[model samples]
Target: MPADRDVLLSARDLHKAYQLGRVDVSVLRGASLEVGRGEFLAVMGRSGSGKSTLLHVIGALDPPDRGSVTLDGQDVFRMPPRGRERIRNRDIGFVFQFYHLLPELNLLENVLVPGMVGRSLTAWVRQRRGLRRKAIELLEKLGLEHRLQHRPRELSGGERQRVAIARALLNEPRLLLADEPTGNLDRASGKAILDHLVELNDGGQTIVMVTHDADVAALAHRCVHLKEGQVTSRHDPRDAERPVQSVSRR
Candidate 1:
């Protein structure tokens, strides 16, 4: 941990398991981590290593059986259901391997989904213009300005993933959680998506990404490896004689 950076998210003694018939499979055992503000951290592990589970626990999407997750100084697991949902919606943004855009909605409409949550149709109608502008701004920033009216089925795989990224940024979240975000794309497409994420991180959007690809992990400020549900090693790329890029103002 750097002395100058503030810890934005922290997890301690996380443990999770599942029942399979008469057997219990433990996915995480005393896993702990700290992510600083504006940092890009990569969690890498083999299949069934509980990498995704850790991300879910920290992002408030799922709870750990025994552990504590603090986000921006708030104990996430201690919050009520509604409070947890609020944190998940307004503070943390998630991007998954599969582009989960609604097939029935256009790109712009899908991007507006987060903003419309918990709002009545009448209330949404009242604020629709501002929400639409925000969505348009996000899509434009993601290079999907011309495809705002296009449905998910009409776009290429890379384009669809871009739309998903735009949707994740619709709320200007404090932290972005990505689970194998480029798992479904080809090498070229994956690199493109990662480049976009790197750019975002450079601009002070904190990101925690889970990836199996070593090349992708190299782009992050730090990489932590997990094995059999425990953090095995932590590596800082800047310590390997690589120049550290200055983070830009958001």
Candidate 2:
């Protein structure tokens, strides 16, 4: 973490485990991390390294067996279920490897799901226009305007992922959490998604991504590697002097 940057999210001494049949498999052990505001941080590791678990913990999707997470000075685990849900809906947006767009909903409607989650029928009716406009704008920004009415099954892998990204940005979340966002795409498609993420980060959207690909991780400002549930190394792709303009192909 940089000394001059403001910390937007922090986790300390995190520990988690799961019960698999009759055995307990420990995942995270004393993991700690701090994400600065407007910073693009990448978490990288091999399969079963607990990278996904770490992201879920910080994003409040799953609770850690022990340790604490603070987001923008508020204790996340300490909040009630409703409060945590609010924070998840209002402050954080998530993108995953699999585009989880609803099969029955069109791209635009899927993007609007988060906004409609807790609203009453009357409230939704009143706010529908504005929300629809925002969703359209986001889809356009992601180059998916023409596909707004198309269902997920009608789109390609890359296009569906782009739609997922658009949906994540619809709420103008303070933080974006992406887990293996390009794992399901080809090299070119993956590069395009990473480029979009870079553009968003340059425009002041904070992001934390988990990826196994080193090439993808290079796009981030800083990256931390995990091994056997513990942070093993941290590095800046720019070598600590100045930031690089873009990721290099290798």
Clashes of each: 0, 0
Record all residue pairs in model 1 with backbone atoms less than 3 Å apart, i.e. clashing: none
- 159-217: candidate 2 lDDT, tens digit per residue: 89988988888778889999999999998888888889989998999999998877677
Q: Rate the local accuracy (lDDT) of all candidates.
A: 0.85, 0.86
Instruction: Report the alpha-carbon TM-score of model 2 versus the true structure.
Output: 0.92
Worst 10 residues of 2 by lDDT: 241-250
**Residues 139-247 of candidate 1: C-alpha lDDT, one tens digit per residue:** 9988899988899999988888989888888778999999999999998888889999999998899999998777777788887877767775544453234423322
Regions more than 4 Å wrong, model 1: 120-123, 234-250
